[model samples]
Target chain A: MAERILVLAEQLEGQLTDVTLELIGVARRLAAPRGSTVDALVLGEGVSALAATVPADRTLLMEHPALRLFNPEAAQRALEAVARETSPWLVLVPNTSLGMDVAAAVATRLGWPLVAYCQAIEERDGQLVATSQLFGGKILADCPVGTDHAVISVLAGAFSSEAAAPEPPARIERLAPPAELDGLRVRAVGLERPEAADVDITRAEKIVAVGRGIESKENLELAEELAEGLGAVVAASRPLVDAGWLPRSRQVGKSGLKVKPRLYLALGISGAPEHLEGMRDAELIIAVNTDPKAPIFDVAHYGVVADLFEVAEALQERLGG
Target chain B: MTLAVILKQVPDVVEELAIDPSGTDLDRDSVSYVVNEFDEHALEEALLLREATGEDVVVVGVDTTGELDQALYTALAKGAQRAVKLVGDVEGSWLSTRALAGLLAPVIRELSPRLVLTGVQAPDDLDGQLAPTLGALLDWPHTGVVVGTELADGLVRVRKELWGGIMLDLELATPAVLGIQAARATPRYVPVGRVRQAMRESTIEEVEVETPVESAPKLSRLRAPEAAGRAEMLTGSPSDVVERILEILRARGLY
Candidate 1:
């Protein structure tokens, strides 16, 4: 019998999280050496359609109204049922807040060893080991699971999404969650989705981000106008987020969204490693700052050594934006 | 009311770290250690909570190594009433949140704090796993990235930061574990006078506990991430730099 690895799939409303696909890519790599099959455990209402998208040889779909909103208790019971049935060698989960909640509960109940935020994983000496960056990516730590069964939560964007194999005996099975909604002590009374305007920066292909050098909120209009003219979005460093000048979502750093775009224009942004990690993937980076020795210049494809206000105005005129 | 804050002593994040000559572990000799930054925020939250409720707060350090004494003492200087250190030298690989929680559950059970606070993620692990694992181990409620917190009617109302700056208001029963995110309130530095007093009077109670099982994730191999595509270095006056940038942007079809 070939070893099997199970991936716990998460969905919001009807769309799968990007992490699900990333986990599939990870599982494919983990399973290749052992000729193992990947199985996806999806729990939610109206999830049969999602089964087609899971990159697994088999999918266990648990459909229930209670599972719709990611109730931890019900989700745990459903996963426990699947684990009992499949007995996978490893259980892979996304490292999102929600995923960690479920993964922790399940691992605790099963008494299985777990490694969280794994950046890399491999089998060595017939035992699985994983590596994760520690100290804010300053130090790397290598760990090995002592138990035969291991649970791991993978960081988002650590691996790019890969297409699921064309077709290979894909089977779907329904599981009835063992717990009831009423049994869940914690309930989400309401969910407030951010308005499109609030998250607009995440999708903007061209972004104009400022750092502490921007000085004050009154000067923000300079950055905003440049963004407006260039048809770009405005973002900020952690200080701006702390200052309430920008929302936390618009804060670009290791703790914030890792963004990749066509063009990233940084203004007065000193390139801290935390900030650089988030935008290092952008295709073209342009930095404008007064200081010639700003670290931003190191990663920037293009840099302007001048006052940001003067540079923004001149660039706006030249680009006709 | 009593609050407990969990903290870890991790290598300084800003310093350049080197691996041991053995290539199997960090070069501990050269690395300076500090309290994990997030844990500082957690400690801050614990102090704030104590002040709000006039509760006695005891900070506990589950030290797997003797190195944690300084961190514990620092927490004491910051306002924790007492400190408890668990001693062992378990390998870094066995330091997963689950394993750490297993070691901490007993100590926490004995203390029986009304609430436990931790950093959303440690600067060392950055996994953000500790709070959830501790919650599961204790069968308590867990909340992550909490920006605002209030105690009302014996329940904890936590404001969690969701995607895109939205807040999720959650109410959990007492005996909850909250992973605090950095908020508008900056963590205060320990006053020099308080540090001196704490060092003079504070003595950490050492609790010897069984070392956690070695469950380090195996690392097959590691290499630095491939260098990003090189940027053409432009050296000239500001106008010349601008012209060169425009030319490059146009070449890349940005214009």
Candidate 2:
């Protein structure tokens, strides 16, 4: 039998996530060089439609009503079982919040070396080598996992979803969750979306994005006014969205939205590499930061070293009502 | 209940980092290190637990740069009941997650803490793998990207951040590790006077830990990110800056 590369496909609300396909895409690349075939392991009720779309050589589906909502302990149990059955060369999972929670446990249960948040994978001298960023992308490390079985959770957006090509519907197989999941301790109560994002900033010609420097939720109106004056949409970095000051769709970053606006105006943003990756393509970049040395200034075409509130008001006044 | 908070010191991102001449690691002579932002939140979470339930919080760190003693002292000043520094072969934080996990599992078992907390991810190692690896090594459950948490009836109710505005409310049993993203509130600040007092009164306990041989990722090169664009620095009055912005926007036919 050909060595197999197993991918743990993630799904939500009965639909597959983009990161799942990205994982498959990475698995395909890693497997192609080894003469290995890729397979997908999906767990959720009524998920056949979603699993069928996996472009792997085989799709292993474990459907159960209890899995409609993700429970890490239960999923880990299922994945542990799947690993034992296939004894795959490597298991690839997306590095999302849920994936991170389960992948570690599965690797531990099976006693396999695991690498998390990998950015690139290359086969070197019959060994699987994965590269991942450390220290907030300041350093990249190349990890070599010996030919022995290993599990890897890949960073989201590190591989392009476009790289995933659809193949003939994969061969389907049914698996079973462990008979006893008593060892599993964590249980997910529910999924909550506090606010629905209403704006799509990807198509915006101009975007005004704010970061933690904005200070308070009330101050978001200042960004809104500036965005309004510039005929731009209002967006934010991850912190603002995490704090619920803005909806998820308005978040512009690796885990949020990747935007290529014509003009990008940043306020109080420190320009973390992840946030910069999403907006570096703007034709005209403007930044307002209180600190003159903020990293955001490096990419801004025009920079203001002053309070964002003061800058927003002055610009709003200059543009008139 | 005892809780272990793992603290890591990262190079202050505010300062410019340069690659060493060898191009294999960060230029250490010019770098100043500070507590990682999220680790502060983890410390704050432990302190909050101390405040609420009077749990003993033990702050643990691998002494990498010989600077961990001062960090542990700061943690003592902030409310950690005990501080420990693992005193050998930290290798400037180059140890792989597996190595670190191997080292911590023994310490955690000796401490017998009900919970272990670490920053969701370190600024340098944005991988967020340490906590989970520690959990796996200990054969305990672990969760990451946790923003808020509560303890009730010997269970941890955590609010985990999922992608795209989704939040998962999970109940994890005791002896679990949490990769804390933030505390329930901002980390409490300690005055210089208190830290100085701690320096005089507290001694960081040293524990020698031996890690098994392990393979770490190879860093072939290190370099600064290329500038995507250059900014025209704007100075002067706020009105001047605003007017300059307007003129440029108008020239570009934007507004």
Candidate 3:
């Protein structure tokens, strides 16, 4: 195999994810600058046929029974096997739930340096420089990766997945699974889908979403009162859900639920990127936080820097609560 | 059988983080430290597992911030059998996640643990690489985003969440590494008095280990996320703010 930009194509339940295309798009950009080619790696049992549409210079599809499902152990082995032989200068993996599972392991296995949570990748002075987010997107760090081989995990949504006007890879190579996948230490027993939300925030017309600023669980009652006045559903940020103050169904964020209600009343949510990704499209956004710098204010159309308790209480009173 | 939980002290995000003169790291002098949230969850999971299986739970951490003692003592107060602090400059300009894992892997292997748990992700190791890196170095299977774990015959059954909140049940052989996202239950709160007593009684075991050769990604700059500047400020007291909010909603015919 020739040296090129390698991309780990992501798929779920036999369908390729849009993020994989986004990775390919990024891989193309990174490869074009240096006249390097791009190779997409797809590891699965019967999903290799799906690689026909990958927008790369070449596609290397590996298959094994252990890869019938998305097992990190098997996926890592396949990626490491391919990377060892191809010796790609740059490898891109989607910074997603599954990608997070395997990217670091693959990099470590290959003895290559890795930069995770990378939102931007650019080569400077013949060196790979990546801008990665830290502190849940509160801070951005631009760093230079190793000179030799580097693995980059690209976060989704940084680039659009418009399908690149439909250009498929010209060459496809089918490879046998490495013997390492024969008897994996880890095996997926089964998968469980998320339980139906008690009240689906996605369909709700109005939502009163509270965050850490709610302080204690008792304050949730204030949000409830305000929600009732507005005929809205009650929602919360990850902290409120993680603390068990609110049910998971009512949580709003990357790991929670994406909601775009008619009106989103954000109280005390710092609006981490994960949280913002879930609810930045609300028809009307009103945010209240003690800190004027809260990212929620950036997304909110009308912002107030005030104590959440006072604001919620006053809003309830104004609404005849 | 033992479950080793790795603890770390990260800059408390609540504080105003100031970039150091290096422009790549935080201004440590101004920042306060707190237990990494996920590691606390890791310890909580290990403790919970120990409560059921009677397996010993040991807490270990690298004293990068020089404040690892408080975290270790609190772990002891919360029912860990022992605490280890690897104290030394493990070959780095700073303690990168890879270096921290390299430094701890040898010592953890010496303990002969059945399972090792750490936070799935920290602000510093936002990619959640500690578990996988340690696993790779130790030649053990590793997984992240794990929420629940149970001990069975010779392996551990874990409940992990995949993308879009899909849950999956997987079984990994013993001597596995887990990057815990959350525990089955909330972390138990130890009384301040209990922590004080633990500090007075328990002694943290210290060991010196030399990390193998590794190159870490060198950060060149750090900056705050750019604000969108889309918000229209609504000023005044609580009542006035509420009035403006009501007016906005009414304009959208939401009321």
Candidate 4:
């Protein structure tokens, strides 16, 4: 039998996160060439119905009270148990905030080559190669998994899932929880979500997102006026929210809402991978950064390599109609 | 009770980073090094946690950079109780996350801290693996992307962030490892005078260890991303650029 390719199916609040679906999508592509099976490991309390929805060759479901909430220890133990039994040739995990807690532990416990922040994984001339980001997207390294077995944590939004829905798993097996879960050290106490925002950036037609380049809270006025002139909502990157200059509702990134407005006018934001993940799909992007090599230019439709304040001021003067 | 915080020095990216002649690493001679930003957050979180719990704060680091004493002295100056540097054979080499974890696991076991705190990610840590790998090697509970932490009755409570601004509260028993994303407050800036005083008054404990075997993907080559950009560059003065941008918006019906 060919070795299986395993994907750790992540879930929250009874729904499979988008990254988990994306991981399964990548695993299928990797498995077809080797005649290997794609197996998805779904772990959570009341995850049986959720496990059945995984689009893989087989879905291994492990449900326990301790597994209901996200417990890094229990999840790692479950994944280790499954990988030990299946002896998978490759494992795919999402490199999101939740999945990072489990991915490295799997590699450490199984003694496999780990490719984190993986953008793509493929077999090239009989060797597995992963293209991953480094230094927040300044460099890309083509890493060869020298070992036969490897663990990859895929970056969210790297693989588009617009393809027709994959077939649901043909087989679903319920597995017993690992004995170690009974006496685990980590326990989930609660989940808290921010109250609904007054403005949903995701629904906006146009957005003016500010980054560190906006400089200070007082300078946010530049972005606000430009956004108002263009009938766009004002959004921000994580640093502005972290600094308390903007509310969490206005933040965009891996830890904030993803938006795809028609026009994304980015100011002073050197695009980090996290910030790019949220708004890369905007219909048209115009970025102004003093550094020509800022990663934002890679995604922008129009690039201005000058002071953002200067550009914003000029644009503001022209927009006064 | 003791709280262990690990620190490291990374090349400052604000300064230009040139690829070394060898092609496998950066040119170390020209780059300036600073303490990893997230590790500074981890140290600050430990200091805050200690304020309520009154546990000992011991900062540890593997001296990869030759100038480790400056970072250690600054840590001591900013309220750390003891500073330990793992020295000797492991200097000047980039240890893979797995190897770094193996090298530090035994030393951390000796301290037997109630909590081990480190940064969630470093520029080189590809998806931030050190804290989790260390936790697994030590067989302790681990969590990352932690924003806030509070010491509760028998367990430490942490606010672990999920996607889209959602937060979860997790409790872990003693002897846990956490990768701190940010401390409740900004990292305290150590005065140069305090750092100088600490250098004269404080001594860093040093231990010698061999290089642990590294298990990592063979990095084939480093290259800039294929500029898949369709961005039309607007040159000339800011007014000219802004005028062109307005023309683009009008063309796209965005104005």
The most accurate candidate by lDDT is 4
Ranking by DockQ: 4, 3, 2, 1
* Model 2 native-contact share: 0.63
lDDT of 3 by residue, A99-135 (tens): 8878888887787778888878777777677988887
State candidate 2's TM-score: 0.85
Tens-place lDDT digits, model 3, residues B1-255: 889999988887766788888787777788788998999999999999998999999999888777788899999999999999998764223467777787888898999999999998888773337888888888898898898999998899999876556787889998899999889888899998999999999999999766546424457788887676569989998898888888888888999
Could you tell me how far off, in angstroms, the CA of residue A51 lies in candidate 1 after the best superposition? 4.4
Off by over 4 Å in 3: A1-3, A122-128, A145-147, A169-171, B90-93, B126-128, B211-217, B228-230
Q: Model 2, A308: alpha-carbon shift in Å? A: 6.6
Q: Tens digit of lDDT per residue, candidate 4, span A212-316?
A: 988899999888898999999999998788778888899988888899999999998888888999999999999998888888899999898999998899889
Docking class of 4: medium
| Residue clash pairs of candidate 2 | A134-B124, A135-B123, A135-B124, A135-B125, A136-B123
- Candidate 1 per-residue lDDT, tens place, A1-321, comes to 448999998886677887788888788887777798888988888878987667677888888876776555466667867887788888988867567667766777687766666777767778667776555444455667543677887776667776445356468877666654446555454455655556556677888899887989988988888777667788888767866788677888655666787889888886754577578778889888776545577678877777777676666666663
Clash count, candidate 4: 0
Candidate 4: segments with Cα more than 4 A from true spot: A162-164, B215-217
Of 2 and 3, the candidate ranking higher by DockQ: 3
Clashes found in each candidate (C-alpha, N, C closer than 3 A) = 11, 5, 0, 0
TM-score of each: 0.80, 0.85, 0.94, 0.96
lDDT of 3 at A169: 43
Candidate 4 chain B, run of 10 with poorest lDDT: B213-222
* CA lDDT, every model vs. true structure: 0.72, 0.79, 0.83, 0.85
Task: List, residue by residue over B1-255, the lDDT tens digit for candidate 2.
Answer: 798999887788767777779776677777889988888888998888778778899999887667887888889999898998887766465565666667778888899988899987765552236777788778777888888877777688888877655778889898889998768777888998899999999888888977556534344555554456457888888889888888888899988
lDDT of 4 by residue, B64-170 (tens): 88888898899899999999998867655666788778879999999899999999977777534788989989988999999999887778899998877899899
RMSD (CA, Å), candidate 2 to true, equals: 4.1
